[model samples]
Structure formats: C-alpha cells, structure tokens
Target: MHRDLHAVTFDCWGTLIYEPKREQGALARREIFRKCLQQHGVEVTEERASDALREVWLRHWREWQAGISSDATDMAGWGLEAFGIHERAAVERLGCELAEASLEQEVRALDGARETLEQLARREIRRALICDTGYSPGRVVRQLLQREGLLEFLEVLIFSNEAGVPKPNPRIFQAALDPLGVGPEQALHVGDLRRSDIAGAHGMGMRSVRIRWQNDDTSDLPDAHAVVDSHAQLRELLHLDGS
Candidate 1:
C-alpha cells in the first residue's frame, strides 16, 4: 500500500515505541510516579499503582476526547496539579527538574524497531516523528531524542507543543508535512490511535497505517489505509523485505 510514498511519518510514543503508563514493568516510571505521589502525602502501593495511573490517565484522555483543547504547557501543569503535586516542594521533589534527563532513559525504542527503521531510512524515504506533547516539553523531547540516538535516524521531528496544535486536527498533520516539502499524498502516517492518527492524517489526505500494539477492539479499520499487528507485519505490509 502506497509504495510510492516518499516519507513515512510515525507517532513516537506508541507506534515506534511503547510507553504504556498503565502497563506494568516500567520500573523507572514507577519510581518517578511514586516519588511524585509521596511528595503530596499520597502513598502508592504495588497493588494500587496500576489503578492510580489508569485513573489519572483516563481523566486526561477523557478531557481531550471531549474536545476540551488546551495548550500543552497548561495542560501538563494541570495534570501535575490534578495528580496532587500542587506544592512547590512537591514539584521539585517529584524529579520534575530531572525530568529532561529522565526522559532520555524512558524513550526506549520498541524491540526490533531500530533495524527496521534503519533499513527504511536508508531507502531515502524520509522519516519524521509526529507526536503528542504536554508531559514533556518540546525542548526536552528533542534532548531526549538526541540522547537516545534517535535523532540521527529521523529527518524531522514535530511535537504538539512546537506546532501549537494537537492531534486529530489537520493543522498538526499539515505542519509535519510542510517542512518536508511533500504533499500529503506523498507521505504515510503510522500511529496507534484511531481518532488522532487515522482521522487526522486522513483529513490531510495522507495514507495511514494503524498499529494494533495495544490490541484495542476499535481497530479504525474502515478508516485506516492499513492495520499492522507488529513491526514485522508492518515491514511485510510495506514490502520492505522485497515481498
């Protein structure tokens, strides 16, 4: 599908990488969350961490889904405050200051991701990152990417904070395409969200691939140009192995 595409832009957090706060095994993230919660006099147990993380994320996700658009700057601050890190000391103790450095470690590329992307990039197909922002500022994100050695493989990086427009909006998609000097039809966007990536890229007239890494039932298949269950499947779908 869309083999003539000049570029393949991806959603960073989920499509090219796995960042599930509600999922377990994020030891570093657990430490960060625990530190933040404790500063506000809230205690998190091994049993309660999952519920708490999900509850907080669900509330924020609902706000966004309900079309309550807010600036990444303010929204992130609101999230922290709502999560009970209201005190100045709490914010400091929560490693907010070390957040930039911490993010470098957190931006782990998905398994088998690097070799695939390296092959894809070497083909002269431009690689771009189109991602949500708010949790970490754009500058910090850039730094993290650089630190993680991902920048060398990416041709362009677009963040909600930098674009001043959130996803599911055509403008954000356009912003990513504009700098690449390519029309929407010449590009393919891969993302994990039905509403945001599929609808948004579709609005911009770009081909879209939905990654089913989370196994969500709402496949967005009717609207998606393609659906991939794994990176291996994605490579096959792209005919990257000479299939």
Candidate 2:
C-alpha cells in the first residue's frame, strides 16, 4: 500500500498555522466595518457591526460546508447588506480594509511547520497549499506565510476564494494537482479537518494525513489514512527522518 508521493498539499488555518489572536483579528475587522459604515454616513453600533460580522461568518460556514467558496468581498457585501447600506464605495472600501485586517494581528505557524516544508523543498518534493480562507483571503494568508518563511517553500497556492470552490470538492484538489502535474495517486494531502481535508483528499484518490498539532477536529467524518500530532511525526511517517 505504498504510493510514491511527488507533491504534498497542505491546509492553512489549522494544519500549518494557528491563529492565536483570531478574536483580536475579528475585532479589528469588526471595527474596520464599523468605521467604513460611519464614513458612508450609515452609523451603526459596535454591537450591531459585530452581529453582522457574525452572521456573515455563519453564512460563510454554511457555504463552505456545501463546497461553495465565499471571499472577503462577498462577506463585505453581505455585511453591508445586513445593515441596508447600499453605498457602492462603502462596500469597496470595507472589502479592501477587511481583507487586510488580519495583517494587524500576528499568526504563528505550528511547531516544525517551517522545518518540515524546508525539508520537503530540499528534497525537491513539490508543495502546494489548498486553503479554505475565511474573511482574510489568499493574499493575506500568503503574507502571513511569507512572514513565517514558509511561503517560499510552496510551489502552488490554491485558495478556495480564488478557486470558487472549497475543499471536499474534487475540483479544488484537482486545481492544486494540475499545476504540479502530480496526479492524486502521487500526492499526499495533510490537513486538520476530517470533513474537508480528509474527505476531500480521500475522495480524490490521494493519501491523506491528519495533523492535530493545532486544532483536533473530532467531526464525524471519515478519518485520514494516517494521523500525526506534529510535523516531526509527519516527517517520520513520510520517511523524511532517514528511518
């Protein structure tokens, strides 16, 4: 049951990086939305802005579960609509600001993430990222990766916002594989979510490894082919430890 892995794909939010200040980022975004609304002469309380942001996130979650992708712009529009703010300029500014809000807060890569990716790169094993981005889009996530020195190690970056489809959808997986010229059988996807990452890669005929170093997803979905708690274990599993 040993298959050659030519390329390795990864999930962003939980597998590689942990958003320790996620709430702070959310609050920043909420404040950005509130100020944007005020500039448009549509005043709303912080509580109401927070509620709109929460509703938009809930909608995004629902869409993601159904394999649909919603980007920052989409969420921005939804947020404006929630408060009956139809100003085109406000939507544009809000989207731009909200997309960049996460940059204000720091994001940390899980232990061994950078080392694992660097080792994979040294071995010429192609790497790609298949991220299901939330309010922050692929551009922001790429910046975060670059800050952690992990972005250069990846060859292809496929974000659901850009692909128009999220993980658990075969198309997203194919999008990552097509650029690498690596088939599903020759690739291994590592992620934390059982529903999206595990199910998506498995359904695409790729081997999957679940990493629970950050968030341990206990969803009632199919389990991955292999499960590791950290990238050190992942290296051992992938025979990268000189075993």
Q: Between which residue pairs do clashes occur in model 2?
A: none
Each model's TM-score?
0.73, 0.95
lDDT of 1: 0.68
Per residue, candidate 2 scores C-alpha lDDT tens digits across 1-243 of 124779999999888887887789888998898888887778888888899899999999999888789888888999988768877777777888988888888899889999889888878889999999887899999999999888989899999989989989999999999999989999999999999999999999999999988788887888999999999999888877552
Local accuracy of candidate 1 as per-residue lDDT tens digits, 20-75: 45233335545666666675687778556555545555665776676444333343
Which stretches of model 1 miss by more than 4 angstroms? 20-56, 66-76, 79-107, 214-221
- Global fold similarity of model 1 (TM-score): 0.73
Instruction: Give candidate 2's error at residue 154 in angstroms.
Output: 0.2
Top-TM-score structure, candidate number? 2
> Could you tell me how far off, in angstroms, the CA of residue 77 lies in candidate 2 after the best superposition?
0.9
RMSD of each predicted structure: 4.2, 1.5
Number of the top-ranking candidate, with lDDT as the measure:
2
